[model samples]
Target: MHEFTPPSGTLLGVGLGPGDPALITLKAADAVARTRVLAVPVKARGAESFARRIVAGRITPAHTVLELVFPMRSDPEVLRPHWQRAAQAILTHLDRGEDVAFLCEGDPFTFGTFIYVFREVARLRPHAPVEVIPGVSAYHAAACRTLTPLAAGDDRLCVLPATYGVEVVETMLERFDTVVLLKVKPVMDALLDMLARTGLTGHAVFVNKVGTDEEAVVTDVASLRGRKLDYLSLMLVRNPARVKEPVLRGCRPKVGA
Candidate 1:
């Protein structure tokens, strides 16, 4: 091992985008390449890492890679300390003037755990240079993989977490012409119920593990109830008003014009 002293350095949180290797941004690739140390988070003992799998073909063994074990379950007491320690580990590398890159799946800011590092690093060492490279979010990837569109014509689309309560989801369904729910692993039932209540269930589509080998898409959300899922998945509900026939009928009906 080697010794170290405090030095100015950059901490790059690079998003690998969705599972498709080609989707990774070129700039993100450069960040990974230049980093003297790469920090990849680990779940439990001997578990396959989703982030690592996304960038497996690009990383080299010569670079220093650190695994910070983060508990998958959300326990208020357990999470903060783990994340705090993880930030310290990363900061240690950065303190040595070594550029450290944290590999993230999809966009680092959207429903991402990297923000834990971002917050702590900001709190503990505010001067550290931080760079966040945008990557393909599961939002567009899920829609594209399922051959669906986020919106059509003048229709407005909203993207939100499916974990929202039934009341909020019901409001969103009525407000937006197209709704995309991200990180849908926990509240599948609530989402399905909202769709069913709105009578849009028949047209809803569920896409799981987008861009990865395990990817699966189902046009019927009704069949998806009570099943296992991935946090990386998303669903799209086609709006009737977004179709050609319906929109052509609405232009003359919206009021005096």
Candidate 2:
């Protein structure tokens, strides 16, 4: 006699795209529709998740919603437990042979909370079926909204977390033709100063909550000096003049008459 085996449920990391419901891909929509359980993450209890809000209209009564509260902390020690707890919660549905879709804002692999939860889930349930659906990243959305081409021809691009400090950003600005600084809130002021000193103020653009109603774009980096911005804000810098410098390349600059 053949042995009977139960099918394990699939865990989907569904990326909703940058804050727009319109940006959700067809495959992501299908995943959302087919999944029996929807796992959403919020910063705190009672707080709304932008990820869930993106697909609010699509969620039917047939779907079971699970809210996973992840503490808003940068420390790994503090975040690990929350991730594990959320993973355990999602596993219950998977154990029942029901698919669970964890809603994520922006691309699931691009600094999405789904990455953490997915990691923990994988660790606990090694054989659990999991699939990731890619969505439009925040930086891509910001670039499109600003009508800025990330790179063209031989132009090199680099993306770094601005939380690494102004010194690191200063180095990257001199190295790449296009530099994207994510998580700009904590270091906005210092970054602004560095931009001014490097004469890249005019070449830089700041975007916050791209594709959302709270979206703000600042072409003038100087204006951001005293202003408070959202944590989701990022700065895109295209330093043609800096790129012309010989330090980045092995050539000397020709002075124009």
Candidate 3:
């Protein structure tokens, strides 16, 4: 008699899009439909998962929902071990030939928790079959909702987390034609000052939870003073006064000439 071999299941990183269920791609929807084990990331135990909420309608009774806690902290030392543990838990299901799909908000690869878990899974299980489905990032949705152009011909764009400090944002504003600042909660006050100082305050727009019921758009940044902003909020700034200095490739002319 021939021995029976159980095939390992595939690991899929599905992006749920910004915050709207309608934004979910058909491919992601199909993945959620066929998923036997769905892995969802939560900020803490017992807390609702935003990623899960984005695809709540797709989850069926046959799907085993697994909640993975990834705390809302910036410290890598604190986060790495937690994700490693989550990867082990998901791997157990995959080993049993159960297809696992990890739900992520926004694009899975863009500043999302799925990347950390995905890396850990790949490191531990090199031969594991894995696939990633990209979705609309928050900045994209925010720009669309606010009718702001991220960039045009010969324009430069810079996107970075606002946690890097006010000085970093100042530098980005000076260099790039457009700057998209994510997670602006930590340095909201400082950023407001920087924007005003740079004479770019009117060009900035703030959007929170785009396409959801909690969505709020603020064109007047001054109103943000002493206000508590949501963690999901972002700021998109455009600098029309910014000038790109031409880089001379040939020999420079004499100063006297």
On TM-score, the leading prediction is 3
Q: How do the residues 188-246 of candidate 3 rate in per-residue lDDT, one tens digit apiece? A: 99999998898999999999889688999999987998898899899999999888887
> Per-residue alpha-carbon lDDT of model 2 for 13-75, expressed as tens digits?
998998888899999999999987999999998899889988999999999999999987888
All candidates: TM-score: 0.85, 0.90, 0.92
lDDT of 1 at 79: 84
Model 1 accuracy (lDDT, Cα): 0.81
What does candidate 2 score on TM? 0.90
Superior candidate under TM-score, 2 versus 3: 3
The top-ranked prediction according to lDDT is 3
Give the Cα lDDT of each candidate: 0.81, 0.88, 0.91
Candidate numbers sorted by lDDT from highest down: 3, 2, 1
Give candidate 3's error at residue 132 in angstroms.
0.3
> Cα miss at 251, model 1 (Å)?
23
Off by over 4 Å in 3: 1-6, 247-257
lDDT at 180 for candidate 2? 90
Q: Flag regions of model 2 displaced more than 4 Å.
A: 1-5, 242-257
